[model samples]
Target: MSIQTKTVKAKTVAIVGGGCAGWSLAARVDQLSANTVTLYLKEETNPSHNWGFWQMPWLSDALSKKRAMWNSWQIITDEGIVTHHSRNHAYCSITSDDWFDWCQKRFHSAATTTEIIRLPVTNTDKNMLMTSNHKKRYDLIYDSRPPKADKNILLQHFKGLEIKTSIPVFNSKAAVLMDFRVSQENGIHFMYVLGYDQYTALVESTFFSTSPHREEVYDEAIRDYLSRIYNVTSFEIVKSEKGIIPMGDVRPKDQNPFLYSIGSNAGAIRPSSGYAFSFIQKQITQFLDRQTKPTNPHKKHDLMMDLIFLEVLKSHPEKAQRLFFKLARALNGDSFARFLSGEANIKDYFLVINSMPKWLFINQAVRVIIEKWKRIAKWA
Candidate 1:
């Protein structure tokens, strides 16, 4: 008797970092196959966070259960408020503690070997990860370390406070996506308020500039908005969260099939808008289809459009309030979400370009094209 046999190799994957990017990747991978996965986390303690990503098809049902969802969101401008409905795909948020717990539970339930180690892995040095406990070399290792931006990068920095008010205050049904009624002295300033309920919410003062505004600048503005706008004065600060995301020029994309670079380091975050959760979710879902070291021609049109948008904002920071509000008004509900997710087609984008301040955008667009072609000419 002749028998033909095949040996299946166990795929071992290692992910370094414990932020939303790493956690999501591990959870998705674990759900798909019985492959061994190791997680290296730097934070010994959970950094409480509220990660909000637009609902996507790849978003697992298990993870969806833990999020706080919003059906509608409003953007405040000098003219008035523009509200967008998320009927099909809602804007959702999940806490860091809950996400970490979910990942841990999944790993524990896995039939294959899986671990969430607290050891910090800096570089891709294989021998360095070898220890008394773990000595196996990973077939694939993903690095989620956030890269440091240049000094002139336009940052979306914010300081938020999640407070519990004495009485019902916030609009529990609709979230305040951006209130651009604040003073624009220190770059473009706005308040992002998300309400879990009428009594509880996260009120954040956000600034779009190179350096963050003073703590007092945000603190005072937040208090004023609460008192003046919502009539919310008596409230206890439950917790505070702070973050900095890039809203600058085009970033270099460095990714590969195996030993991939994931998260913000891989340019998952949209440069014009500081939204990476959706992009990260999309990238993690396609574990096998990642591009290695993306060049200018990969998504040339989309990248160029985003770069031009960012350039307009950087060159004329004062125009952000008008540009953002107008852009929101131009796009429909579905299109707005698509734009945020970086999946907007030419038609959707053209609608936005037409809504902007023509002179401001036109000048920036010309400069961006000239500079890009100049670089190409030199390289050629």
Candidate 2:
């Protein structure tokens, strides 16, 4: 466990894994690097994942042409369809291929000692990292590979289908957050996004289930949504993608010395919503801000939000579901739209959550209180 201090010298940062989190961190480190930075991707191939988020201007430079831009969004429910005009945010999307191109372009533009190595990293940090084929060393290591999680814990997974048609049944300007009409059973959330009617629509169903059985559930849900809601059976499958995001509180015990967890491995994914892109970006920004401090890279404020939200999620999974769905119902149209786009404020967030059946919110509140007491008692 070599814990090196940050001297004025150009320190080498070896970031393992070249996904959105790894690439984005590399780009930022390149910007901040008074020293050198290196990126390692396990796969020798270019990126092949579809990455998307409500387009925040902060990440505009990293967005690729596969990124689609939308101005409005919606949330569908059994009650009715509600739409909101996006005021502060635009729904932007980028495919994995496009995002890879964008990051490589940025890496190319940077003058720092930034290099992306396409090889697997050796598990040991003692000597020069000796891979089966190569050797390398770094002043610091950031590993973003999927951490082995406790399987007994449940994780929320989703499979999305990107469909296109000649006769668009979706509103070109609006993006749906969650279609509650898709049944609230087994902790599932459904959503649809229409990008300019003819371009394509991203429809997804999220299940608070395991990665193993998500495909069948998603396929069945998608087919049902298309037939009952869209009233269209003859649509071309433009593309399909699925993502597994951990929604549990369990994390790696701070037992590793030199290697620090990053991205989902670092507990950067939001527990309630499985949103990691923005969260990991935020963590990287903060890490850069305090990189000079004498502290463990993994032990930071990043855990605060994760812990808080995870408590809510684990203690009251049903309440978590109810809270979100109720917010979808309360905010309905445009409010729900702007909220997902990351434009809504704290007041807006609370107002929407507050609208759920008061008893459910009360139950959530009580659970939180009890959990906190247990923690305090244990510490005492």
Candidate 3:
């Protein structure tokens, strides 16, 4: 007697871009079946930057490696300060260097064959990816390269400095999400502070605008902010980081089934808030659960709300502070965190809508609708 058996070959996966999304997906894929994965890194080492997100159950492992976590955070404006405290979802931050190290450790610990190559993907033809030194074909390709910025698109840009004071000064208990006491010459400017301890903190000068200012401009702002707000003029600069994130509708360039866009290129960023870490996590989670290609994980209604909010900011930049303050005041800490993390419930959504200025929102909503219609017509 004889029996016939069938065996299937493992899939070959190629992931482009070495940023958070690429590494995150590679780590997950390394744990799956016997898939052969190749992660292409544009650079040998990732630049250091802080990725901030709120704590959630699925992110408990990442949270364990957090550089800093705060149970309370505050938003400050000329009118007053609004403090929020969350017992369940603490705001946490992790640096890019640490995240890459963690992902690498996980990759090595996994029992699958995964190779990381430091090469920029120069071109792609069908299922083949061409690098400067090598060309390879794979069953699936996940591209996390940042989407090209559209002309005149809204942008969130910031430069941060990790400073150490000779004496204790910072309040380590809470984080300053937004301090609007700084100059508003730029569009929708604010200072964000994460006090790691009494002697150490990261102070960033951020702006939501169509164009970012020069690096020196942001540096001067940070200096002025520290001198005026903290009254500390002498501090040692430990490290610095700067980044520019597009805050508009960013879509994938192609619609190939085998080639999937996995990160901000697939619209993981919230247009209004410029937050993508949590959404990227959600996208990865859904992709793994369904055993399918990843798509944009944002809900339609939430995206629409973000569009309207962005329109409001574009039309009335002066109202930015008030809008943020009102929205923060309307929701509790948990609700606010959930809303920002894109896990808000109906009640949370309602609170956000109710907190906005009625006429302003209506006007912006109409504008967004008309703009979308015009785009469709132009395409047609």
Q: Model 1: runs farther than 4 Å from truth?
A: 1-10, 31-35, 44-46, 126-136, 249-258, 288-300, 374-380
Which residue pairs clash in candidate 1?
A: none
Candidate 2 — which residues are off by over 4 angstroms?
1-10, 32-35, 44-47, 63-66, 126-130, 183-186, 210-214, 250-254, 289-322, 329-346, 349-353, 357-359, 365-380
TM-score of 1: 0.86
Ranking by lDDT: 3, 1, 2
Per-residue lDDT of candidate 2, residues 298-332 (tens digit)? 23333343345455555565555455555665673
- As for candidate 3, its clashing pairs are none
State every prediction's TM-score relative to the real structure: 0.86, 0.80, 0.95
TM-score for model 2? Answer: 0.80
Global lDDT for candidate 3? 0.85
- What is the C-alpha local distance difference test score of candidate 2? 0.62
Cα RMSD of all models vs. native, in order, equals 5.1, 4.3, 4.1
Ten contiguous residues minimizing lDDT sum, candidate 3: 1-10
Query: lDDT (CA) for every model shown?
Result: 0.73, 0.62, 0.85
